[model samples]
Target: MSWSGLLQCTAVEKNGRTVISDCYYEGALKLTRPVYLHPSQPTIYLIHVGGGYVDGDRYKTEIMLQEGAHLIATTQSATKIYKTVKVPVQQYTSAYLDDQSVLEFFPDPVIAYEKAQFYQEMTVYMKESSTFIYGDIITPGWSESGELFRYDWIRSKLKIYYEDNLKLFDHLYLETSTGMTGIFQMEGYTHFGSLFVISPFMTQDLLQKFESMAARFPASVHLGWSIPMIPGLVIRVLAHETHAIETIFQMIHQFIREECFQEEPIFLRKY
Candidate 1:
């Protein structure tokens, strides 16, 4: 029902603290005042005025962090993509990080209802001295009829660049045409989640530590950790529910906060 929306935000360090230097948004996209809850980072929550996205909607965002700045960007709530008959929803995000800067982009999960079609493309450009943490989840929307994985399609791609050179490219493509019920596809799972950390802090030692954590997941859940061509680690998870994956990501976030930033994890209270 909407044409498109755009949000642009720039962050800079001032007096040893990160602040939103400039921000602008249009259409359904909105942003709240940046909050410095933690001494090491400033937090910003993106808000959707419309509550959910619908067919024919296109949204894009760009975030820029100046040198030595630290920011955590997240959404107020889960993004819901409603059913569609014709047009598909499209979303694109681009982030630029200067040397010694840090960015933590952890939006809530996305729920795709029956017949919904969604596509997302994200690119992050950073210096080798910068740190980045990004994550997302995709789950079938609730249905009164108890149907799941009925969405028409859900495709997402993420690309990371260090020193303006491509370091990692991750992709996920799913469609109803491929039979979502197939064991090789969803494998009876209703949700999939991913967490990525790109930083010089992610050494082989830390990778081994995270691998120990991933190995503790229950048999019902499929969790894997891998080192891509980039200088970081990726955590991929599939499960019948969402809470397990969410908890693991939170633990990973906490680990990064304590080890790399030497700061305690501040609970992101939305209420």
Candidate 2:
């Protein structure tokens, strides 16, 4: 494994269309070419040549968006963290967004296999007018005994700043030491997902609309959203299956695309 792997990219607006101004990557982390599913927004996929992360691996991703540039990024597939005896697999991500820019990151779930330990830290610096949407799922990997929560632990810390002021600081940590089966822990749930949106377009009216929409979903999925904190909101979901949470997030994503961006729902076109 490489000691330190990096995937850095910068995007800028040119003639009303966003384009990659610069990109550099090495080791296991690589980026696919930008695909313009939408004329203005480019979708880029992050690829892991090794297919999965293992012990003592370290990765970093840095993204820069010039004024008015918009980008959508996702992984080619689910991120799998395998068994580890020593150092935990680590990933660090940072992004800078200029005025009126946007970034949408909707990666697939991360599965931690038996005895795995993983850690992630992400930070974003953006103007109040800039928009950011990020969502992901965390799932327990399969084990020989068919026991869930076989992984050692998983942790992630996220920090969002608006023009030098910290707007949100979220920390999620779960360890088997605390009994993952406990009520405060996984609580018999098999998966957990989160969606975070910080945009000028999120208003109280939209929040109400989403609340009503989420309530209509079937009882199999458990999901809730925070009240709009003016420019930011959070949604947490727990479900027995991955598709249940994914369906809910997809509807919300479609709403944002149509109502706020005046565009059709994005199709990643993974094929």
Candidate 3:
């Protein structure tokens, strides 16, 4: 597929700190200046200059980290997918993490408007000693009729490979034509959030922490989490509003940062 925008960036450990060593971007995709919120870790925000994705648009991204490097990546704002006339907007991202590195990717939610179609896929390659954390949320966009789930469909796929072997593969397809509120579907929930954490720190004790967190939420929100075959943790949530899911995800992220990485729970500084 011909991409309308392309973004490539590399981070390396230099002088005991991680920094963006190389960056190349064109078309609609760009990145903000690297912000060092925590001395050793750099946070980068991905931006889409086009404001929103349109039909027949394709975007590609590549992120690489050298050995002993750690980086945090996030988006400037929610990804908006507008109504399509011919085809769905597409995006593909590939990330590579070297030995003993860490990559925390936390992007904003995706809003699919009425008659909108969006397809996204991401793949991560890492060594056994590296750590990877990714989080995403999907919410319906506004419509004139104020109807929920008015969009056409959304297809999202994520694949993780560790030590050159596939550790996790998750594919989610939600189609309005197939009924999103019935059994086995979203069950009337208007928002979906997913979090994946792959690191040696994901242990049985971590599961207990997540269990306690789930117990705090009300019945309006549903939280489901599990430990995959690999040494990782996966959590999924269904809620009526975006804040309900984001609050829980942020809590877990903060815990992992302070406990596992032994760093302060800092903010991304969205405001």
Candidate 4:
């Protein structure tokens, strides 16, 4: 079944200096239920909904954040792109952040079955003082079913903008036989994820703290935090074990929550 929905959030300061709006979609199969979360009175809301895909199934989501507002959005579970003999399954997501606004888009993960093809893209617009933390986890195939890295193709792109100026652009392409043993490849890792955190308010000391915490993990787990082009930190990890990667992500998320939001992480309780 094909389904679609949109989510919008707007914020305005009391002095009426700034205004912004954020919108997105949450839709999937009709058989499953959509997850919802209302964190604050009128500022934060999280919704996650997805379902099985058969033939010619399409999923799309869009999010927009108005100026001066803060928003965090996450998925309840990883999205599964089922393999089909006839047509390839598609999932599209787009996000917009208004001037002086912040948005965090971190989905659970995307699981691709053998012979499945998937495409994804994420775009962000930023203004001065606007911050965004975005990431995604991708797995080759279901481990429980004895399936290893057997997907056909998985492609992703990320674009970042500061006002009318472009800050960062990235593209990634992966396949089952992408060579997991090479020095620059996945290096025998079955699952991988990338995290990008952008904020001008971050200090050198804080960056050091984050890096130190990341060093506690295994050497195989790649971690890097920097402010090379953008005023934020980026972490990339590849692990042969899914749980290990998940644990590291959870820890990093919690650290950011405490430092940025001054609130406890919510996903731990929900998971």
Top candidate by TM-score = 3
| Per-residue accuracy of model 2 over 1-271 as CA lDDT, tens digit each | 4645799999999999999999999999899999988988899999888989999999999999999999999999889999988999999999999999999988888999999999999999999889999987899899999988899999989899888898788899989777886687777888999999899998878777777777778698767778544486799988988778888778888888887788899865365
What's model 3's lDDT at 137?
94
Error of 4 at 266 (Å): 2.9
Q: Rate the local accuracy (lDDT) of all candidates.
A: 0.87, 0.88, 0.91, 0.65
Better of 2 and 3 by lDDT: 3
Across 1-271, the per-residue lDDT of candidate 1 in tens digits comes to 4537889999999999898999999988989998878875789999888988898889999999999999999999998999877888999999999999999998989999888999999999999999999989999987778877778899999999889899888999989777786787877777899999999998889887777776666677787778877678888888888787777788889888887888888666365
User: What TM-score do all the candidates reach, one by one?
Assistant: 0.94, 0.96, 0.96, 0.79
Candidate 1 accuracy as TM-score: 0.94
CA RMSD, predictions in order: 1.9, 1.6, 1.3, 4.4
Would you list the rank order by TM-score, best first?
Answer: 3, 2, 1, 4
lDDT of 3 at 46: 97
Error of 2 at 7 (Å): 0.3
The residue ranges of model 2 lying beyond 4 angstroms of the native Cα positions read: 1-3, 228-230, 269-271
Candidate 3: pairs in clash: none
Give lDDT for model 3.
Answer: 0.91
Enumerate residue pairs that collide in model 1: none
Which candidate has the highest lDDT of all? 3
User: What's the lDDT for candidate 2?
Assistant: 0.88
**Lowest summed lDDT over 10 consecutive residues: which window, candidate 3?**
210-219
Per-residue lDDT of model 4, residues 50-148, tens digit only: 454444566555556666666666665667777767766665666666666667677767888877777777777777677787777887766456867
